[model samples]
Target: MQIIIVGCGKVGSTLAEQLSREDNDVTVLDINGQRVEQLVNELDIMGYIGSGISFDTLMEAGVKKADLLIAVTGSDELNLMCCLIAKKAGDCLTIARVRNPEYSRETEFLKKELGLAMVINPELTAAGEAARVLRLPTAISVEVFAKGKVEVLKFRIKPDSPLCRMEIQEIGPKLKSDILVCVVERGGEIIIPNGTFVLQERDNVYVAGAQKKRRNFLSVSASAPDR
Candidate 1:
């Protein structure tokens, strides 16, 4: 895929690097000449030094032939304008990084009016993640899937915990909850554990299940007496 990224800051440069590594043709555009040069030197991807909202600059960056355009400039309005222009000029799929909370609420409206494929707000996403972690304090990370009906949680096994040295097969019978252990990370290695797999202390465990079952499992696990 051919992708054009606007801005040379952390997010834009990181996306460029990752997309380039994935064998995608990536072109980075920014008004800062030095930043564009640095990224070009480091990543060997195409770089354009100009305002992203300008038609001439975008045309020079081959926006007409690009498959996707991502605008992640510091200014939300500028990013939106870039996407708007990209949509008009190339009719390509466009993504914008809009950080302002006020604009976040109007995401659907903006997408409808401006023809944006996606609007990403990093701060809002981080806040949601923090809230999820706060709700489940024992979890290192919590990811919701299937529109909140399912969840994948990561947590470490504490020493002397009931889960320590327990076989995966015993969890359903002992805890009386249905949860699937998806991955276990221990000693710098990752394992897809089977029912017979025994969990050791300090192992990072990832489990996935329906929301109600996961909640029940966590509640039971948290209330279990250390053995």
Candidate 2:
């Protein structure tokens, strides 16, 4: 995939490095010549020194041939402009990092009006994730995907829990829940669980399912006392 990253700050540089590592052709741009040079040297990815919103700069960055454009400049408005211009100049998928609280409520509006593929607000997302984890005390962490409809939750198994001695295949029938046990972390080893895999106490389990279903499953798995 050909990806153009606008800005040479932490986010942009990190994206460029990760994308390049994944075998994508990544080009990074920024007004700061030094930052661009550092990224190009460190990541071995292409770099351009110029404002992202400039038409000539984007053209020089090969936006026309880019599969995607990501804008993470310090200024929220600048990032938006970068994405908008990239969309018009290249017709590529655009993702903008808009972090201002003032624009938080308008993210949906911006996405629709600007035809943006995604609008990311890192602070807002982190706060939401932290809140989700706090709400689910049994969960070590909570991650949402598929537009928040699906969730992956990590929680530890307790000694007295029914799940401790249960096989992966028995969870659905015994617990009467639809959640899938996707991964298990036991004794510092990560395992992709199969039906015959018997869960042990102190194991960290990662489960994925719809919100309501997973909550129901967790309630049963974590809230029960010893028989």
lDDT of 1: 0.90
Candidate 1, position 43, lDDT: 92
Would you list the clashing residue pairs of candidate 1?
A: none
Worst 10 residues of 2 by lDDT: 218-227
Candidate 1 local lDDT, residue 122: 86
Report every candidate's CA lDDT: 0.90, 0.89
TM-score top scorer? 1
Best by lDDT: 1
Model 1 lDDT tens row, 108-161: 999999999999998888898888877767677888887566769988887756
Every model: Cα RMSD to truth:
3.7, 4.5
Count of backbone collisions in candidate 1: 0
Off by over 4 Å in 1: 167-173, 176-198, 209-216, 219-227
Worst 10 residues of 1 by lDDT: 218-227
